[model samples]
Target: MLKLTDKQALEFGIQPVHHQMDNGELRFRLTRDTGSSYILTLSAEQSGWQSSHVHLRKREFYIVEQGWIVLALRQSEQLTFRRLGPNDSFMLPPGLPHNVYLSEGSVLHTVKYGSADADWEAAPELDEKLRHETFDGKTFFTR
Candidate 1:
C-alpha cells in the first residue's frame, strides 16, 4: 500500500497548490480542483496599505477567515472603494483590478472558481507598508 501527504501530493502533480506574496502578507492556493477551478488561502499581517491592482482573466472570489482588511478595487484606479471584514467577502467579476489592504494579523481564505492567470501588483506608493512585511511566496516569518 502507498500513501501520500498533502505536500507530497502537491509535488507529484496529484494535487496543485501555489503560494504568493502581498508585499509582506502571506497568501496561498490550497487544495485546488485543477480540472475546472480552484480555491486560495490568503494570510497576512500588515498595516498602512490601502490599495493594489490585479489583472485576472477570470472572476475571483474571496472569503475572509480571520482578522480585518480593506478592499479597494477599481477599473481605472479612480473608482469608488469597498471595504470588507473578517466575516465578509467579495468577487472580482473578471478583467478588473483588485486591491486588498491587510490590517494587523489579518488572514483571508479565498476561493477562486476559475483557472486563469492573475496579475497582482501592490501600489508603488506602498513602500512604507512593505517594511517588516512577512511574505516569501511559501511561508511567513514575521520580523
Candidate 2:
C-alpha cells in the first residue's frame, strides 16, 4: 500500500487528505468538511480486509473501479455476503455491521452521506461470528 501525505495529495491534484489504514488500505479524501457528506477513494491489494464496523448514522455508497471485493454483512443475527466487481456498486444504510475483502489491485470510489463525524463503531470480534468458505479464489460467508 502506498501512503501519501496531505501535501502529496495536493501535489498529485487529488485535493484531499491521503492516508493509509493500519491494515495497509489507502484512502484519498476527495471531499470533506461538508457536514454529513464526504467522498473518498480506497485501494487495497489482494487478501486485504477492511476492519469490521458499523456506522450509526451514515449511509455509505461504493463504486468498484477495478478488480473486485466481497462484503460481509451482519443483520438480525444473520451474516450474508456479496461479491462485487468492476463497475458494480452497493449502498449500505446506517446500522449495518460489515467488513470488506479486496481482491487484487482493487480500487473503490465511496460516498458517505448522513454524518461527518463517522460515528464509526468497531466490531473487532465480528470475524469469529461468521461461517465462511473459500472456493475458486473467492470467499463467501454466511451465518
Candidate 3:
C-alpha cells in the first residue's frame, strides 16, 4: 500500500473539478488513480450538499481532514446519518446508496476501489431535507 503525508499528497498535485450547487461551489480534486482505486480530496468553498449516490461495483471510503461532513447511508430499508469531524473515517460497501454533505470550507479525503470509472446513480430526493440545512461549526441547523 502507498501511504502519503498531506504535504506529499499536495506535492503530487490534483486535478480539481468544481461543481456549482445552490449553496456554493463544491470542489473535487483527484490526486491518484491506481486502476483498482482512486484517491481524491473534496471540499466546499462556501456550503453545499452532495446528493445521494450509489456505485454498483465499488466500495467507497473517506476520511475527514478539516471541519465536518454529515454522511447518510442507506442499506436494505434503513437510512442512517452521522456527523463526522477531523480524522473520522467511514466506508460503504458496493450497492449502498450514500450522501455526503460538507460544512462550509471543510475538507475530506476519499478512496474508491473495486472499479476504475465511477458509475454513480444519484438519489437527491432521498435526503432532500438536508439540502436546506447549514453547518455551524458544532451542529447543523436549518437556515
Q: What is the C-alpha RMSD of each candidate to the true structure, in Å?
A: 8.4, 5.9, 6.1
Q: Model 1: per-residue lDDT, tens digit, 50-94?
A: 345554555567676676655555545344445566689887775
Models 1 onward score TM values of: 0.59, 0.75, 0.67
Instruction: Put down candidate 2 lDDT per residue, 40-98, tens digits, no spaces.
Output: 54554535567789999888898889878888888886778888899999999999999
Candidate 2 lDDT score relative to the true structure: 0.73
Q: Count the backbone clashes (under 3 Å) in each candidate.
A: 0, 0, 0
Give the higher-lDDT candidate: 1 or 2.
Answer: 2
Which runs in model 3 stand beyond 4 Å of their true positions? 1-23, 26-28, 31-42, 127-129, 132-137, 140-143
By lDDT, rank the candidates, best first.
2, 3, 1
What are the clashing pairs of model 2?
none
What lDDT does each candidate get?
A: 0.54, 0.73, 0.68
Off by over 4 Å in 1: 1-4, 7-22, 31-45, 48-51, 116-143
Estimate candidate 1's alpha-carbon lDDT, on a 0 to 1 scale.
0.54
| Model 1 TM-score on a 0 to 1 scale | 0.59
